[model samples]
Target: MGARRMAKGIGEFLMELVGEAVAEVILGLLACALLLSLGLIAYLSWSFSPRLTVAGAGGLSLFLAYGAWGAFRNPSKDRRRRGVAAVATGGFTLAAATAVFLFFYGSDCGCL
Candidate 1:
């Protein structure tokens, strides 16, 4: 094949790989959000408190679940478009989880 065709082939392959990787990560984030949401719900039901964990985890779960669903389901229609969104969702989830951890277990709060 010509060089241009070869380059196009490589670009297509890379795009496909990126889409698949994003899908996997988005799915994983969805699972994490679901689990965290369930845990927070259990804690709320059992403990009954107005705390950072409840609000943060609950909000994170809601955002991730919906965002991941949109990214996972309609990938083909906008593969390149949604791929970035999937990656962003994962990144945001990680940030939210870290913030939640720091807020709940920070030295100032005395959870440790």
Candidate 2:
């Protein structure tokens, strides 16, 4: 009976960890999708002024950076896993920032 209880406890812990991981993945994807949609809108909207575009992009980037930092700063028993999450979050943040910048400023470049 004691061994069976121990097994059940371990199963529960594993399930909880899986749930947390799934939640994190979903949140990350949602963030990326939102940023992508914003970039598309900014790119396609001719009436939106450059100043407003820059301000909106900067604000969004700052907000996302803060959120990503907060979400990934927690101590985890699996350091490697945490490191991967941090890297993924940082990459997504960078991508979002770059998309916003390009949408607003890429036209200024002569190469385009």
Candidate 3:
């Protein structure tokens, strides 16, 4: 009976650890994707046109602002994780918005 109890406790601990690890891994992937998309958008906009450059920058700035707000709004628990998630969410939104804009507004430079 004691061994069974120990085994159960260990299993619960391992499950909790796995959950946290999974969350961190997901957040990390989001950060990476955000950075990569931002870089790509900047590069494409640099040579495309002033209109696109302005639009992309504006959209990204808005996302950043929203992320900052979210991070500050909930400062009691998991502050670091919340901040990371906010930034990742903002970046993903910006990237998606930029993609949609590019898709419908099709650049004339043929670089897209």
Candidate 4:
């Protein structure tokens, strides 16, 4: 075997995606909620508010990408399916929660 697995062809990747249930978005969202709730409790020890909790939780979630990166880099074929799930869930958490930081104080995304 090569030092790294061969890159997947677009057609094969598409077929794999088509066969998967992509709606595990709900699982990702639940993880975001868990992070937020945990942050809220931790923040309460110092000072707390809904806004800070959301932003802080979102900020903390970027750490999840380490797991995704590791999963992608691992050499085992047996764990590849679980790795796909990890990437999807981690990608959603990183994109939706870390970048979003939403719905506190009737605020917008404030991306600008």
The sequence of per-residue lDDT tens digits that candidate 4 reaches over residues 30-108 is: 5466566655678794475767767776665654555555545656856544665577556655655544544331132
Ranking by lDDT: 2, 3, 1, 4
List runs of model 1 lying over 4 Å from the truth.
48-112
CA shift at 92, candidate 4, in angstroms? 5.3
TM-score of each: 0.40, 0.43, 0.46, 0.24
* Model number with the top TM-score: 3
Ranking by TM-score: 3, 2, 1, 4
lDDT of each: 0.65, 0.67, 0.67, 0.55
10 residues in a row with least lDDT, candidate 4: 103-112
Clashes of 3: 0
Model 3's C-alpha root-mean-square deviation from the true structure amounts to 13.4
Relative to the unseen true structure, what is the C-alpha lDDT of residue 16 in candidate 2, on a scale of 0 to 100? 100
**Of candidates 3 and 2, the better by TM-score:** 3
Higher-scoring candidate on TM-score, 1 or 4: 1
Question: Candidate 2: TM-score?
Answer: 0.43
List ranges where model 2 is wrong by over 4 Å. 47-112
Could you tell me the TM-score of candidate 1? 0.40
